[model samples]
Target: MGKIVWSVNFTLDGVVQDPTGEEGFRHGGWFGQFGGKDLDEWAKALFAEALGTEALLLGRRSYEYFVARGWASRSGEWADRLNSLPKYIVSSTLEEPKWSNSTVLKGEAVREVSKLKQERDGDMVVYGSYQLGRMLMEHDLVDELRLMVFPVVLGTGERFFGETGDKKPMRLINARTVGDSLVLLAYELVRDA
Candidate 1:
């Protein structure tokens, strides 16, 4: 079976929105609010991991946002690999995808994802799909979580884990601090053991 893994970047106070200053909310791009050379390499490595992902799960908003960025035009080993992988978008109103290698979930996201996990394939990675993450968590579909915690905090904005009434508990699998204040935290859902 495959794993439903979530990889996301968040602020110290847990905000996960507009870390690149290219979005709304006035004050954005908090991820690079403070910077260093090593940090760049770390970010690159993180994105490289994402590129190697076999499949991507995204919400309608994040899917549209990413597709608009011309990810296919970017050139690199990572870009090539990322553009080649399959993407599943969870949406009701989105009738079509502008990006290549994209597909819409035909039915309930939880059921579709559960079936995908049952298949013999590679990791099903989820990036920046905050609302879909919450829904998956609610349905007990997420197998693992990989969070890159940045140094600063945006006093108000979207968060990594939203309100999902206790569908399952989480167990910390591993954790480490990278560079000065960044933390890499991984957790697994405690379904049975």
Candidate 2:
């Protein structure tokens, strides 16, 4: 069975919207606002995670965002891996996926993703799909979380997590500082028996 790992970059204040500023969020581009050795380290960490990922699980909006940003045409080890990996997009309205090796999951998000976890092996990483992530967490389908928390706190924006209606316990598997500004945290969801 595969684990659904939700990997994302968010600010100190839990804002996960438009880190790249491409979405035109009022306080966008907080991701690239910092520079230096820390930024490079963060990039390396992301690349390492991408290398280990078995497949990509994305929401429709994130799929569009990546496609619009030209992730498909980009070249490099990381870009190549991302482009070639099997992309499972959770979208009811998307008729056909434009990116290569992409498939649209048209059923209910939770059920579709739960089936996906059983069919695949290794980690199916979800990136920047806040709504999908929330849904998965609420349904207790997310197995792990890899969060790279940036130092800045964008006072207002869409947060990564929402109310799940109950407390979800997590065990911190790893914690480290990436460069000088970013903190990388890995947590395994503690499921009830």
Candidate 3:
């Protein structure tokens, strides 16, 4: 069965909004503040993670964001892998996805994702889809979380975790430093019997 892994870049304060500063969030561009060898290591870590994942699961907003940023047309190992990977986009209104190997899941999000987990055999990573991530967490559909935490703390903005009603316990499976400043933390959800 497939594991739904919600993986993304986060700040010390849990903010995941507009790391590139493209969006007009008040604390936008927190990701670009760091540089030097550490930033190179961070990029390498991100590339490794992308290469390791079997597929991509994204919400409509994130799908649009990536497409708008020209990831669909970019030519490189990372961009090519991303464009070639099977993508499951969870969107009610998106009738046709323009990205290659894209599939739209228009049914109820929880049910659709649950069926997806049963049908696939590898990890489907969700990146930059906070709303979808929260929904998956609430429904107990998320299998793991892989967070690349940056050094700075954004006091305000969209966060990775929201109100999920109940506590979702997790077991730390891996923890390491991506660079001098960036930390990679992987946690598996502890499911009840």
- Candidate 3, residue 79: Cα displacement in angstroms equals 1.3
The number of clashing residue pairs in model 1 is 2
lDDT (Cα atoms) of all candidates against the true structure: 0.81, 0.92, 0.91
Task: Kindly report which residue pairs in candidate 2 clash with one another.
Answer: none
TM-score of every model versus the real structure: 0.88, 0.96, 0.95
Give the number of the best model, judged by lDDT: 2
- What local lDDT score does residue 15 receive in model 3, on the 0 to 100 scale? 91
Supply candidate 2's per-residue lDDT for 62: 91
1 or 2, greater by TM-score: 2
Select the stronger candidate by lDDT from 1 and 2. 2
For all predictions, the C-alpha RMSD in Å is 2.0, 1.2, 1.3
lDDT by residue (1-193, candidate 3, tens digit) is 9989998888999999889998899889999998887789987887888888899999999999989989999999989989989999999999989999999999999999999999998889999799999999999998999998999977899888887788888999999987688899999999882
For candidate 2, give the lDDT: 0.92
| Error at 31, model 2, angstroms | 1.2
Candidate 2, position 57, lDDT = 98
lDDT of 1 by residue, 83-174 (tens): 88888889988998877788898787788878877873777888888988888888888889988888776789987877767656788998
